[model samples]
Target: MIGVIATMTVQDGNGPQFEAVAAELIEKVRAQEDGNLLYQLTRSKADANVYKFMELYRDADALRAHGTSDYFRESFGKLGALLAGEPQIEYLDGV
Candidate 1:
């Protein structure tokens, strides 16, 4: 299994938009990706504009496939404009 953690900072006043877009992304993956083990988008209680994601895939191929997915390309392209800064991502293994 592979785990991924990501932190995203939504643009000022764009939190709601980000949430809506992210929700759509979640639904897309859930409906289409068979190798997905876990996927979640979380907002920080202490920081209104900060969001995070926890994702798990079966293996490296699953992870790589997600990158080429239509939802990923479309969502990331749109989400980038709504973010305040570059998203931080970390990969985990041997867990």
Candidate 2:
């Protein structure tokens, strides 16, 4: 299994827009991606503008499929303007 924690910082007052895009993508991922064990978005308690994507994939191929999916790409494109900067990603191996 593969775990990923993707940290994203949104521009001031852009949280709603970012969340909307993420929400749509999350729905699609949940409904369409067979190899995705989990795909959830979480907001930081300390900062509303900070969010993280917690993802669990069945394997490397599954992760790659998610990364290359059309829905993922389109959603990310929508988020570009709302982001403060590049997203930070952390990959982990399941114990």
Clashes of each: 0, 0
**Residue 27, candidate 2: how far off, in angstroms?**
0.7
The total of clashing pairs for model 1 equals: 0
Off by over 4 Å in 2: none
How far off is model 2, as Cα RMSD? 0.7
- Measured against the true structure, the TM-scores of the candidates, in listed sequence, are 0.95, 0.96
Which parts of model 1 have CA positions greater than 4 angstroms off? none
lDDT of 2 by residue, 1-95 (tens): 99999999999999988888999999999999999999999999999999999999999999999999999999988987788999999999988
Positional deviation of 39 in candidate 2, in angstroms?
Answer: 0.6
Q: Write the per-residue lDDT of candidate 1 for residues 2-49, one digit (tens) a residue.
A: 999989998789999999999999999888889888889999999999
Q: After superposition on all CA atoms, what RMSD does each candidate show versus the true structure?
A: 0.9, 0.7
Point to the candidate with the largest TM-score.
2
**What lDDT does candidate 1 reach at residue 17?**
94
